[model samples]
Target: MPDSKLRLPPEAVKKQHSLVWRIILYFALSSITLSVIVGMVLATWNYHRQTEAFQSRLDYIEAGYTESLGSSLWFYDETQIHTQVKGIMNLEDISYVRVTDNLNLDIETGTRPHHQDIKTIELVYKNKPLGNLQVAFDRQAVLTEASQTAIMMIIAQLASLLLLTSLLVFVVHRLITSRIRDMALEVNERIDSNSSEALSIPESAVHDEIDILIHAFNTLSEKMNNELKQKTRAQQQLKQVNSELEDRVEERTQSLQTTIDELNHALKALNKTQGKLIEAEKLSALGGMVAGISHEINTPLGLCITIHSYIDDHYQQLKSGFDSGQITKQDFSDFVAIMDESLGIMDKNLQRAAHLIKSFKQVSEDQTGEHIRDFSVKDYLNEILETLSPKFKKTRHQVHIDCSEHMRMSTYPGAISQVMTNLLMNSLIHGFENKEQGNINILIAEEKGNAVIRYSDDGKGLNEEAKQKIFDPFYTTKRGQGGTGLGMHLVYNIVNQRLQGDITIEKDCGCEGACFRLIIPKKLDVSDS
Candidate 1:
């Protein structure tokens, strides 16, 4: 499917323009723009130079012919003046010249054009003004010469530009563009034929980008071809398996009825066994709670008993001294002191015993019954931990709880207690199995009207497989050990079904131990209950 998508469409290939033509068009436009600019600058410079040369000719005529013409005019020689005027006209760009004496005699040569520049010079000989000489320059003729030169220069530039552009186009097309077109055509052909043939590298003196592209394309083609071959083999194997399955189906039809009966019987037995195991797990949890509470209450009760004995013995001594009339003020004072100290000790131990019993009773009822009620999250968690203190007190493991004292929830405390019990047990049995000491932290907060409980342990963290199947029933890492594997499974059921909540393991928590997050509604709906 992916390979078919990778094949280029025919319309796309047809619509693609030739790379060589695009390059040529761009190169030609740039060349023409540059040539036009340079030609304008050169033509302007040539025009200015021609104008300067014309000015130089006028200067020469003023210096060389002015004195001679002035002498001829002073001598009143008309022929000599005419010859000088004619000679001046023969100079470049001088179309007309005239010389006149003071007596109004004039000699002139050449015809003046309409567009001409006239220069007037004084004719002087021996410090005497003879006449005024006027020279006319043809502005049109000078302009014409500059125009001709500019035209020739532009023509040569254009010719060179055309030749250079043609050469570049030819070389670029031959070296790069032609090879690319060939590769495209070959690729299109292979796509049409559904062939997996690798592209052929073109002949080149040096390896370049084009060669690299060919190598990469060939590698991709070979990989795709291998994949196609594997797919073909897989399809053939699937057909063979289908044929064999048909034969097996016919043979299995003979015992189909027997298998159905046996399966039904086995399913019933399995259900019965599962029910018993679940019941046993619950009983086991309750039994452990009882043992823990009993062990906790023993210390306070024993202390109270010893204190009671000491108080009674002291009272007897006081009574004996008073009855014999041998009790003095010091003895009475000592007796009062003994009585006060003993009573205080006894009262403290009795209070301790009462508190332990109260915690045990509350946790026990919550674990046994499915009653929903309002309770403080912090207080209830402490009570649950108190009941499980025996399991923790035997080891150096510590449990810490972080929750607001005022935070409350209206849900099944029994389900919550059971979930917590199973989690702590998992941490003890699996997470901190071989560790001498570990820390268990429980953080409770409210988010969006839901009680968010984050529980983590500072023990060996769970592996990938354990994290994946940790909630699956009968999926225990310790198969032969005293691991029921139903502890976490029961926790999953209680949180999801009983409490109508979600529980998930935090995989990327960066903790050295396992971490689990539970989110349950602070108040369960009637329907949920």
Candidate 2:
């Protein structure tokens, strides 16, 4: 048949084979097919039995008619043969009947329904063959009856099958499908709700496989819920621990920050104190200078007074001699000579005093004040050494100045003086601390539009550490011995900041003492200050 089953669409086949529909279809098809097969068997058997009974009746009738007709045929009576054959034909389903004699003479009545449906018999008289008879049965009535019986049987069987199938489907739906749907719904509800509550399926007194499935799911759900609860508890504990840790960390950070701020505040205060201490030390040095210069000026003033006294006395005596005319020419000349000599002595003493006063005044003014002025490098350095004489006076240490006398700079005189003074004092105190004699050298020159000074002392030089921190404030080698540590630091500040230049410890200067080189602009940019 052209693979008709395979020609069906896949979707159609799937629908045909669906569980519920397939069940119903299978039940219907099997019932109908079985009903058809059984109906056919029963109908065939009934038709065959009825047809045999009719054939038996026809055979008895045919025998009696054949006997009576055979006697007539022996008498050669055609009327009697025709009458008996006609009687057999009038019977139901007898389409045709025929009789024949020994002489081959035949008599017939009615047309045969079909040649293939004919039945034939031989008539015998006294055990001798007399003639033959043939008859055909009408098959349409038997076929009609058999067809009706088969249809009725098929209808009855189909109705009963349909009822039985419906009952089975209903029972299966009730027993299995409904329970499965309810369980599925419950599972969906449990998932959607995500509740801690366990799933519940109503159970009958008689339990089945679904109950076992529900029990397994319930056990699993309980385990999951228990685990979920444990996880929640652990998370809450972890969150609490994290909160505690964060608080502790914040507290620690705050403590560290407070300590840092306090340290910074203390550091600022210490720096301010250091600056004040440096200034105090500078003033203390100035006070000592003042005392020394006072002692120095006293000597010159004493010489001037003594010289004035002598000159006044000589002038009075000479005036007296000249006015009274008792003086000889030689006496007058001697008086004039003596007076001139006295005047010379007085003038010399006064000049000496003036020079001392001038030097002291200029040095003091430069140290105590700030002003830019033109000054000879050699002369100004001599004045500074002179003012600082008292420091070296007690010891055998001597300071030497070497510079171009003609080299003058237009710069901060006071700042320069202070820088030189601090350097000198630092050498006297620190460089020559325990020495009996030391030589201090201050060399000045002009280089690249700047005044360069190389100050060194032939005393115990500084070590590498001291040389590095020598310019740092409050970094003293003599901390407990009233060493303020500001001398070199002040020198550095004055040279670098006020003079707009730089200073360095010249390690390669080939000196046994610490050689400090200062370069100051000849004309300072005061605006930078």
Candidate 3:
């Protein structure tokens, strides 16, 4: 089965390049296509003009041969004419000139087969027509000249094409591609090193298509620079305004802080007085209840003692009689049974009395106070913390103890124990309720003959409002959750009144969350002069 909680979306990454590459490709393709078409048309026209001129040359040579042959004739026989024409036929453009007679078929030519072309014309004298002059042009020679001319024409065409192509490619590549590449490289290098300089196009370049384009690009760049300067001006103004705004914000913050501090101090004084009043009230109530409970337990206890004493006297009398052989074995057993019943009643009542006394003593001590003891603060604090092991384990709380090694001071163990226990319980119950983990820190030291103990936690701490009143007696946030509201008050009483020390709490620094500080003197009411 596919996991329902698996992520099915793409994470953010750089996008692939598409736009700029297409532009470069389109520009190069268009240039090449335009160049090829123009080149082909010019080459075709050159080929046609060269071919027509060669054909005209051939026609002029043929006409000159006919007129010269018709000028005169030694005889009206073909044999003499052929002999005369062959003697004067050794020229370049006229490959061969031949006159052949229609009458004599023998020895009628000037090496007839050798001189290939023949212009046939009638030899006439004074209105008398002679035999025809037939001249032959060499088929092999004419075709060879035509082939060379064709080759030269093709070479000329190719040369022109090569020159034009090279020029176009270089102009487009250098005037366009190379220049652009240089500009791009310059821009890229500047950007890499964080330099802000405009790219300048090279001069000595004429007005080609790319030259016009470069001019446009340069104009745009200048316009952009101007706009950028305007933007920079606006940005500076915004920065100044922001700085002023920040100063105002800071002033307001300090004012708010002062107001908050005063409220905290007032609330603290109120809570201290309130705690004292409430603690006195709870103490009075507890004292009265303790007295009543003691009285109630003593009545039943006294009755059991009276009943046991009376029964003991009877048993003693019976035992004395039995030992003297003045009583029966049945009488002895009955007396022993009665004594056992009396002892049982007495033992049960005594146990009940002992329980009442222990509960009363514990409540009285916590409400009133505990005896002070001179002991090492480190040892005392450790004992209290260990006694809080149950609370720590239950709430999965972590504790850190940082104390000066080999430093010892005199303090009350019971007071510290009660104070530490109260704070730890408060943190575990309220601070780490829904948290994954929690921390409690215990620090001990001596400063100028005064012992100091500090305890804190990484759990959720008191809010701004709650921090002020959290130490107040009977002012509990855990009302429905079995909070007695007397825990911190009791702790305060134990620390300040009983132990003769002062306490201070540190609040949040506005970082990740709240931080609590507990600063206490190694000794109470000590001031540095």
Candidate 4:
């Protein structure tokens, strides 16, 4: 399409008169018209003014001549009249002076120039009119002076008009016409496809509408160029993206398949490991119960053995006294008393050992078995504490179970027992490392159909690293000192995998020890195991 800027061709521009020339012509005509009007008005006014001045001069001459001429006419002196006329004729701007007698005789002096304005006054003596004095004024001298003035004025006005028109033409050509020509050339160049670079124009500090137009066109050019570049880049990018997308989709599909295979293998391994974990969990818990029970049983059994040894010695002394015939009634009485005391001590210690064994047996049975039964949560917590009592008895650490006795759960009691055992042991071993006096609190409550257990201790809280890996298998702070690390891991597994519950280490726990929050379902799904 042809650009609007090039709508007017060079030949057309030349054919069309430039605005500057037209304006100059119009200005010249207007100036000439105004000058002519002003010149005519000034000439008319000058004519009238000169006429008045001339009239005054004529009146003065008439007045002066009246006295002399009246005297001349009254005495009938024609020579004096002639002399006076000649005198009037010698005055400036006076072309001809004429004198006429009452007899109708006329006399004149000086030559008549081109035109004349004549005035007549009668000579009167003693109130009687004498011959009339006709004074004629020559307009030729005034016309000559006025003609000189008009010539000068025309010259000056013409010069000024010429200079102004020239300046106007020069300025208009440079500022407007030339710039328009440049715009046309630029548009023509742009229409040529080979010169399709973006248009650029030099800008002036001060600008007019044409400059604004140029700026707008430049902006459009820049925008089109940029859009074209962007279009090319976008097309390339789209192609690249399409190619890459196909490759990525293929790679990702292969990767996903591999990941699925790896995941299946991992899941199988995890299942196998889970079975071993269950067994290990059971053996570990049973071992702890056995150790605690044995510890407790040792004391009572030792006492019983001591009592038996004493009773046997006393019996031997009695037998010896009887054989040697050196025994007394007091010795027999002492022997009977010792025997009674020994029997009573033996019975009490045996009963104590049996009780310890029974408690261990019950705890072991519950922890190793995943049997679901209705059990009081509070009472279960107490039982686990009792079974683990030997571990804490030597320390000044206090463990409090804060749970409503009425709070019961129809879930796996074994899981509950094992979880509590692990948490207590974790606190004792990891939390209260060397501290004798510590406090452990277990708060159990029901919330939204789940038993919320908050267990914390007043011992050194877990560090950042420990908190992060606390539930990871074989990750223990006290690895060599029989930490085992499985306590918390086993607890996590039981609570999450078996008990169908969730547990979180609450960092904001208002205690100086690690706090574990366990949310166990009141009713567990036994099939999950």
Candidate 5:
């Protein structure tokens, strides 16, 4: 039946949120409170105004009655008094009128019967007219007036309160909360997106603490991004610096290695010079020995030469004699057989001496030739073995060259020549030193598009300790008597560091003797030199 009895939604009962709604709420509440206070004050004031006004009207009537009574001995008839009271009742602004004879104590109304308060007033007036006016006004009009004034006061107080509350709410929202909400929403949006861009707050919104917060956040985000970029750039710069440092270290190491190589080369030249001196001394000694031995052999050689000459001179004579029957058949045959045997021995000695000199001369000459050519590898390398044939023969070492024919390429012929020469000498002097018959196999073939060269020996397989240092310069298993200890070191340098080819010691069951596998490019680039 009433709006107050109806249920309200949760939101309606709950606190308001928007600035405008809160402003409405604030005004409504303030207006209600002020109206309540004003209603109470007006209620009190209206009650007092009615009380004083009614009291004054009662006094004015009592005074008029007292004056009109005069000095009569109180003998007014009840009928006459009632008529005079009826006259007073007709006056304007008066609600009721009554008269009570002061002496007889009799009350009369203006002809109409009334309720019993009149009897009580008659007793009081009969004793004395010196009491209160014995009449009560209707009072309905005063009650109505008070009620209407209270209602109007409440409405006016409420209206003024509402206006004042609204003004305050508007001022607070504009000055503070509106700007705060704007800034808060901006920050929340940026945080949700994880963006680095500065928030653009309104210039009007920029005020007090909220403005400070916006600027600080923008600066913080900008600083963080800049710092991260700077860190990334610094890391890149660090990597570049490290790379440059590494390159510098490598260059320094290369320069140092070049110096060491130059020194080694100088040492090799010195060794060669010493070898040449030794050879020259040996040659001089050999010449002296040859001269001295020639004198000792001169008589015999002359005898042999003279005898052979005589034989040559007489061979036809002897044959003619035999034919002419100047000698017997048995004697001629015996002389011919003995002379032939002596001449053959003399011819073999002269040929053996010549061959010895040629073999030594070849070895010396080979060491001197460093020229490179693109000769057939098989032919070029085989010739090297052929030249070393005498040395192999003395040591009784077997050698093989398995390079394919027609497999030609441009390379340093001198390097390969020296490499092969040294390897053979190494095997002869050290590999087969204790063995009666040593076997060395060299294979050069193409495998999987790369030139493959392998070296292996069956004499005494390389010792494990020696194998490890086999490529180190001046490291050798061979003693000075038979080796210069640079063979494998030189081979390693030529095959790997110089030729840009890879070389590895092949896996052996230890039965492959010392096998080395070299994977060489088919076309050797000479730029490494």
Candidate 6:
């Protein structure tokens, strides 16, 4: 019995001690359940009765007040109609009352209920049909009454249940629980002292189940005592084996922890390396733009210089002719014309150089910092294209921008510039690889409070494999021929993370080229950035 008790689940032992309470609780729960079922049935019946009474009240109102209401409405007596509807509002469960005539005169009182318990009664005056009267009934009153009755019923049933449970607890404790509790206490004391004494049975008791239980317990106690003596020796041996195993497990755990720490360190290093690579890619693009802009600026600056030299030489000639007193009207006029033409050419070249410089400066600043500012989308795209004009000047690739002038956004323009730059560069380098001529079209529009950009190039489009892995870092078709493969990946990151937007390639775009679609919010939240 002791071994079996040890093997029994903890809940079984708890139930043994709480046997009396469990029985009382079971009895109370069953009684409460039966009471609740009866209460619900009574409440349902009362609710139906109340509903019928409410309907009868509506019928009474129609029979009693319909004629007076119609007569008041027919005479166009607004005061009388209002008075009659107000009286109707005083009835029980009547939430709202409204009277309307054929002349579109509407008189209503009280607030309408949310539930649709409305009744419409047609008004008739002297055998002629007038407008109708609408009465809205409140069903909450019926529910409230039913709830009150059920609550009272529950209170009465609970009182009866408590009385019965108390009586049952007293009977069960005297008859059964007291003996069981004594046995439990004796067993606990013996187990704590490692003794196997038999439980004491009542001397006056008959040889019933309780006495039989005591005999069985005594037999089990003797056998358990013998088993305990044998188990004591085996437990001592197990302790030594367990001690050795614990040391081996501790050593293995330490080795595993060391490997985990090394793996974590390696992962951190790898992530750091990846970040550095992404930064290097951005810097490389910036450096290329710097080189391109510098080369572009030289041409206009060179023109300006040549025009200045020509103007100076002509001025010297004009001064010499005037000093020698041999300057003709035609000569003077011709020198004026030459000076005018040279100055105009110089001014034009200088302005061209200045415009180029301004565009480069803005693009460079935006690329270096993530600043939020309001900018016209069309104007910004123009500025970006101007900075990239040097790349397209030699190619037959015509770039077109289609966007609304009023469309604007407040976001990280640097990220936008980077994305545009990468896309244009990709088109020029890979899309238009060996082709002499290609067309790139950019269409920008506002869609659902977001800026949508569709950029397509009429160059060699991507295949299934290339399209699938196009935005993956370090993936490029031109791996050996100077393709860093980070352009599109950078664009993807900028659009998704920085701009809080999405970009997708239009798979079945009718054009025989790659079409990339970008959807970015017009106004970015600071927290999102």
Task: Please report the candidate that would top TM-score against the real structure.
Answer: 6
Q: How well does model 2 score by local distance difference test? A: 0.79
Q: Candidate 6, residues 368-466: lDDT per residue as tens digits?
A: 987899998888888888888888898888989999888889999889999999999999988898999989999998889899999999889999998
For residue 115, model 4's alpha carbon misses the true position, in angstroms, by 99
The CA lDDT of each predicted structure is: 0.83, 0.79, 0.59, 0.80, 0.63, 0.86
Predicted candidate 5 versus true structure: per-residue lDDT over 1-529, tens digit per residue: 1123433344432422355566667668777877777777787788678767656755665565544432122554445555555655654334566554434444534333345422223223344543222455545556677778888988887767767766877776776556655555566667668877787875544367667777787899899889889999999999999999999999999999999999999999998976575445334333433443445345456666776776776577677887888877776786678678767766765554454445434434444454444567787666566455545656667787887798875656555655666666666666676788867888898876567788878756677787778887667665665455555766777677655677677656354466778776666666655
Backbone clashes in model 5, listed as residue pairs: 105-126
- Please tell me which predicted candidate would have the highest lDDT against the true structure: 6
For model 4, the superposed segments whose C-alpha errors exceed 4 Å read: 1-278, 322-327, 405-407, 446-450, 479-485, 522-529
TM-score (C-alpha, index-matched) for candidate 2? 0.49
lDDT of 1 by residue, 164-222 (tens): 87797778766776577667778888988999899875646688778878888888999
lDDT measured at residue 519 in model 5 versus the true structure, 0 to 100? 77
Q: What overall lDDT, based on C-alpha atoms, would model 5 receive against the true structure?
A: 0.63
Instruction: Indicate whether candidate 1 or candidate 4 has the larger lDDT.
Output: 1
Clashing pairs in 2: none
TM-score of each: 0.53, 0.49, 0.30, 0.48, 0.36, 0.54
Residue 205: error of model 2 in Å? 52
Quality of model 4 by C-alpha lDDT: 0.80
How close to the true structure is residue 467 of candidate 5, measured as C-alpha lDDT? Answer: 70
Error (Å) of candidate 3 at residue 26 is 99
Model 3 clashes, total count: 20
